[model samples]
Target: MKLKICLGLLMLTLGGCSSLGVEPWQKQHFAREDMALNHEKLDLSLDDHIYFSKEGSSGGRAFAGGGCGCN
Candidate 1:
């Protein structure tokens, strides 16, 4: 009961998703190697450290998130 309510509250607080409707050619520029979220791997490590310390999330080379531990 309490857990269910807490889960619902958490989901509601997370906000809804958005879609850019991007296409293949439209993503060409964003596909560049240097356009990655971690082009030099330095920010990747820093982000991972922050995430681990605050959210307990960990992953590599992927966009993952669904309220799961692997996210």
Candidate 2:
């Protein structure tokens, strides 16, 4: 029936997702500098400082105010 076919297809799709991540031995390769989110660390830090100063808030701090510029 169509229900059985859909269930089998769903199961197959879900099963395929289990092999999607990096293995233990592959972690070292992924941790290299070339795989970093911000290749220019200084530039990224400067940008963050500028944003925080312009918004007048230090993000993720233990303060009592919102820092996302929505207020």
Candidate 3:
């Protein structure tokens, strides 16, 4: 009986978190250009290209070394 009550309380607590997310209509707000995670896509790509080229390695955004000591 005690275990059943604890499980019910836990279920109710978990169910309360379901109301915390965004609704369907609110999605459109996030889809706007101003809400983008990366506003300057092209510029960022160009910068990355320049940086990688100067680095002289095909390393990515990780802790990849430059032209030397990349292994």
Candidate 4:
């Protein structure tokens, strides 16, 4: 019984990992414009400009604007 349970668990783990990666045929779907990380360059640039203007600081930070915006 122990051997059967271990084998079942191992098979389940392996089966779960077998489909973890993207297949070659699915590359076309993943390469679509809607799937991009930054889909709109112009809008992203404009947002970056607004963020910089409001926060008065550049990258390397996470929290919203409130303090002197140093660092």
Candidate with best lDDT: 4
Which residue pairs of candidate 1 clash? none
> Where does candidate 1 stray beyond 4 Å?
1-18, 43-71
lDDT of 2: 0.69
lDDT tens per residue, model 1, 7-67 = 9887776643233357778888898999877697887766665675567455656543344
TM-score of 4: 0.46
Question: Taking the tens digit of each residue's C-alpha lDDT, what string does model 4 give over 1-71?
Answer: 99999999999999999979887987997789987867786886666657777665555433443434433
| lDDT (10s digit) by residue, model 2, range 1-71 | 99999999999988998868887987997789977876777876666666666676464522334344543
| Candidates 2 and 4 compared by TM-score, better number | 4
Residue 21 miss distance in model 3 (angstroms): 3.7
Which is the leading candidate under TM-score?
Answer: 4
Candidate 1 vs 4: which has more lDDT: 4
Residue 28 of model 4, lDDT score: 97
lDDT of each: 0.66, 0.69, 0.70, 0.71
Per residue, candidate 3 scores C-alpha lDDT tens digits across 2-71 of 9999999999988997867798887997889977867776876667666766666554644443444322
Q: For model 3, how many clashes?
A: 0
Could you estimate the TM-score for every candidate? 0.34, 0.36, 0.38, 0.46
Sort all candidates by lDDT, best to worst. Answer: 4, 3, 2, 1
Clashes of 4: 0
Candidate 1 lDDT for residue 45: 62
